[model samples]
Target chain A: MSEKLYSISVEVNGVARSAHVPARLSLVDWLRDDLRLTGTHVGCEHGICGACSIMLDGEPVRSCLMYAVQADGHRVTTVEGLANPDGSMSVLQDSFCKCHAMQCGYCTPGMLIAAKGLLEANRHPSDTEIRAAIGGNLCRCTGYQQIVDAIHDAARRMASGAK
Target chain B: MKSAPFEYLRADSIASACEALRREGDSAKIIAGGQSLVPIMAMRLVRPSLLVDINEIAALKFIAVERDAVRIGACTRQALVERDDALASRVPLLRQALAWVGHVQTRNRGTLGGSIVHADPCAELPLAAQVLGAKMVLRSSSGARTLAAEEFFTGPMVTATDSSECLEEVHWPVWSEPRTGCAFTEIANRHGDFAMVSAACQLALDGEGRCVRAAFGLGGVGQTPLAFPRLAARLLGTKLDEAVVKSVAQDAAAQTEPGSDLFATADYRRHLAGVLAARVIRAAQEKAGGGK
Candidate 1:
């Protein structure tokens, strides 16, 4: 039997888009497969690992655990939305590159999204806060020190208004 | 692992949600926050025919302090409760316990009702609710009813709420007495992980620095959050000194019947339960400014 589909309209990465998706289609799958926004990777899919993290209504949440239909009429910010409007590397991405925060790069997208969510609310975060922000997003590479350092560096750059 | 195909219905109000649930009966499940339900669905542990999304029900998302009690709307996000300064100050134990519920991302999407309904024995929220003597409001197409935390939670992953009923809100009686203090502590393999054994205590001290009231709740040590009124009675009218605390802890360990699990042996959990009970009670006493 053909699965039923639901019509969902979501504002994704600042773009208003709509799609007909299976009711079971997760938000992450809709973004990556249907919308062709592959930056959001799926790791555990069970709300752990945080690789499928995305900003839902300005708050970071596990997209894999949310159905695409549940996100209808909502605003979603994927990792692709973290860059500047002009498409240049954002400060956080730049700091991650400079700090050598990734090795396999699988977890980088979720980490960046998580950091962006945190920075939006907290302009200046302490080391503990940085650690707590990325606590859910696991990175097997860089030993987490460089990731923390990158976030710290990004916070400093953002605070200095260096943009 | 994708969930089995299911119909999705967005609920704009609690009445509509209950109506849908009543019509669909066992075939329908309510999804708030989708933190716990989605995970179980993905694993194929539950395959309901319909998922009633209650996230848009704005009326079910609030934290209100009325009179001497705090009423938390079922859909209020865990992160919102975690950061609410007023709630933290009023029900300090809840704030401390919330920190141990998953992570910031999970808490951002998880709801108070979801955690309470999920009723994981290791969950901190249920234990905290039990310790606070919280009451859960259940609504259906028929009408509404209330159940105490002790009565609401029947067993692990089980609740007294029927399929036609939606948990509306949870009411926690605020500890407003002078020098009242509370504490929640657990032993988890990692931060934000499910506890192997957890303990929560709320204490009130009289003007003479004697224990007036004490309540204790233990998690991960039983099928449901265990409360020991007899053990709590032992500390009443006495100074919560080290010796008295030790005896109470021993009684708690002996009273609980924690089963063996892969994470820890039953004896180990029992031991930790006692140690945690003592430590948390002492910590609560210290917070109340009554500890020696």
Candidate 2:
């Protein structure tokens, strides 16, 4: 059976984009397939795994559970948006590398987006807060200590005004 | 997996949302946050013919402190509730329970009304609402009405709200009495996962440090959030000593009718409910005593 389509205009990664998609099309699929922004990974189609996490209106949300139509007229920041204007690695990205936060890298994008969302709200999050922020993002590789360390390190670096 | 094909309609106002719901009837589903609904849709568990998107209904997203109660608009995000200092102070138990709702990401998109309407027996918000004796405001194209939490939740994933009726807001009473405290405790498989067993308690102590009133709610151990008036009555006029609390907890646990699930056996859940009831009651007592 043919599916109905809806037009959606969203501001993704600071850019205005428009698309005509199926009503059931998830934002993650639209981003990965239509928009060609493949950095956002989809692990569990359900909301359990945070691999599909993205910033919806500056707050981390599971994109896999959100329809593209629902994202219409909203702002979404995927992992691709976490880079500097000059295309260099963002502070959190660099910290992830420095701390060896990812081994298999399957869950990196969601982890970075989650960490970015956390550092944006709390520039100086405690260890407990850091743990809670990335608690949704499941990283089978790093055992989460490094991910927590990366977020903590990024928080400190950002607080110190380090670029 | 992708959800089945469906038509989508965005409602700019509550009236329009209600109209759409009424027009579409049972085949239409309201999408607020879409945290729970979309996941079920992806699994092809439910295929509604139409989706009335209420995320743009700006009027339905608010947290207001009314004269006698705190009013949370149905669409208010869970994360907003978790971070609101005023809400935290006014309803500390709700905030404590929200932390256990889902992870930060899920909370960012999950709505208070959606969770309450979803009515998961194991969910934290519904249990908190039950223990707090919150009121649910339901709106339809024809009129509006309110129901208590106990009346609103009929069973697991079931509520008294009709498909045409929108859950507009929830009013949680503000405990103005002195020496009042509330606490929530749950045992989940993981930090952010749904609870295997949960307990929430509210206590009000008299000037003499005697229990004046008490309410306890148990989740993941029954079809709905379970509360025992008889058990609560047993604590009245007492100092809530370990012996009294233990007996109350035991009675509460015995009253639960948990069904065996993949997560836990019915017997294990009953046992955990007792343990959690005792723990949260003691914590509420300490908090009432001005302990952090």
Cα RMSDs, all models = 1.0, 1.3
Q: Which lDDT tens digits does candidate 2 get at residues A90-110? A: 888999999999999999999
Clashing pairs in 2: none
For all the predictions, what are the DockQ values? 0.85, 0.88
Residues B1-292 of candidate 1 have per-residue lDDT tens digits of: 8998899899999999999998999999999988889989999999999999999999999999877899999999999999999888888888989988998899999999999999999999999988888999999999999999989999999999999999999999987788998889999988888899999999999988899999997999888888888889999999888899999999888888888867889999999999999999999998999866
Error of 1 at A72 (Å): 0.4
Q: Give the number of colliding residue pairs in candidate 1.
A: 0
Query: What lDDT score goes with residue A40 in model 1?
Result: 93
> What TM-score does the predicted chain A of each candidate obtain versus native chain A?
0.97, 0.97
- On lDDT, the leading prediction is 1
